[model samples]
Target: MGVSDLLSLIGLFLAIIAFLDSSERKFILNKFSNRDFFLVSLYLILVNYLIFYQWWTNQIEFLNYFEFEGFPNTNTWAYFISIILIFWFLYKIMYAYFPNENKDKVLQFYKYLIAKKEYQSLFSYIEKYDFKKLRSKKVDSFQVILLEEIIGNKLFLKETASYNFFFIIELLNTNDNKVLENNFIYSQLTDQNSYTLMNIESPNQSFFKLLFHNDEFFLKSIDHNLRHNMSDLILLNKYILKFYLFTSQKKIVENTEVIENVFLKIIELKKIHILNKYFSNFSKTIVFDNNNSDSFASLFDLIVNQLNQSLIVFENNEELKFSFNIILDFSLNHYEKPYLKTKVIQSLTTKIDSENFIEFRKSLYECWRKSKKENESFNNNIIEKISNY
Candidate 1:
């Protein structure tokens, strides 16, 4: 009826409306400024005083019921009760809304990807569904490409893809080694992945940072379980880069053109490794049908050409030896029959006649000789092909 009653009613209405609004939780603490707090406190005190005065003078029935022998002011008790009820109501409303808010769709989707073992689709999946929520403003295409390589490599290995893994590469102002080192330390605690391509002691610190620290902040912002994993593929790809492309002492000065070239080489080597892994099997030889043979043949030619070009930069014989063994393994693994095996051997002998090939040839010759000694008829044609070469 009076201004105090009107103000109290308006306050009650606002409090109830706030309780009904879902987004009020975000603003509840922010809604009260120092001025708002002082005003509300003064208003409650004034209203309580007015009620006590009116009740004492008029002897109101309901007001007299709350009287006591002690100095327990009824209007003061009423004011406290009203404030407590407002807070209790807000608390109940917020509790009901918060649990539903915590059921974040993006987080659930990431967990789903991990459980389904769809690791290779992780980057695209995030980009398609939850990019805005998960991606940092500094994220770049290189980081995404690097993540793709990390997850895609799982397809080549027997290991299960991990959900708790993060991939970070320092791309910005890579001239700073200290910054790269700091990021490396952070990535370790976060990534459950057993292997990381990050080379802390790399002499080419600048480039190492570029290759390993491109999306440091972006990666760290993502959920650790969603982001961290045993980055085997990228690490293997980095092994090729660290050993083959970045072998020079002056790699620190290598320009973008050189870095881009190295990336192309890394991609090519990955392609070769993929072909070797898919086609070569100790368990059974792949029967290259017309459907697959064309693809197989193209990958085979690409591998041979890449290996030939590798001879220029490969300083270590063991590196080329490993490459030769991969080729030999694939050649031997894909052919079960003697003629098919011999045919692969012949093709290999033509491409593999260097000094390195001779050592590899002798090793194959001994293996065949050992097999022949065990059975006297293990595959005479393969031994003959090696001997002729």
Candidate 2:
């Protein structure tokens, strides 16, 4: 190939680029992938075609022409480097002479903080900012609200400021919604003391919201109410209880039956009705600690026995039977322990007060304890519990 062939090849390459740029089809096709594989396949096809073109023939041909001496010169290392330096300098000069001076670099640090849900770091750091100071900078734009992140066709101020470098900000929407809208707000610079209130309008109930700090400069004290339809609140209650029951980091308080009974009622009236689905609920959270391997399992054992006696989910549904069996199997395999034997006895004493169900649990514990004191593992204890029962 000579200078002429190279020019023709470069022209073809440029035409492909132009066609791809003008059409989304090329992106979907991904024709640029695996060029080496395509080349090898082409070579094999050409060889096969040659055999078909003329059955018996022997031929060899080689051609070469070059005017320049030492085409593969060692000096090319220094020359190519100098060429790169020259091009970089030219690009810098061009950037400096532009209308807005140099283009600002994008800050990438915000991506990690938001995506990882590193709530403590994100919220704590945002609390410290005084938005009034950041407003002074000659920034280009304030992205206080990304309209897409919240409810569709609605607005939310999810992210506002740059994490690494500052930029100018401008507010585009002043009176976007006339009705209730405020969810929260934020400050990017402040490290403490950040919250905002949004009214949660309901038929009889009310709620206030709070936001962390942010510094994108559209600093306004304007707050809005969050109105909820009946269905919305009902759905929300389910999620809130699930989150509360599973995520509450507080120590497991040793509540009396009075406390536990009240808690169950609250869960039934406020929490259970709101649940969209209970298919994924398990006795233990994914971490398998079940709050703790001790007091909590004792709690679960009591709860499951109570569930067996309840009208909550009538035991006849085959699907529910499977779910209950899973709960029992996991509890027996993971939670049975000798240490909780006396604890179970004490709990049974209180629980039996007058009900025969209490004696049932007491009997179950007797079987559970004998297996445990005999140094049975979880499986053997489960086997022993079944045999004794």
* Per-candidate total of colliding backbone pairs: 16, 19
lDDT, candidate 2, 76-113, per-residue tens:
43344434544643453233221221111111222234
| Candidate 1 C-alpha lDDT tens digits along 181-205 | 3444344323444233233223244
- C-alpha-based local distance difference test score of model 2: 0.32
RMSD of 2: 20.4
- Look at candidate 2 and tell me the lDDT of residue 130: 15
lDDT score for residue 369 of model 1: 53
Question: What residue runs in model 1 are displaced by over 4 Å at the alpha carbon?
Answer: 1-43, 46-331, 337-347, 373-383
The total of clashing pairs for model 1 equals 16
Query: Best-fitting candidate, measured by lDDT?
Result: 1
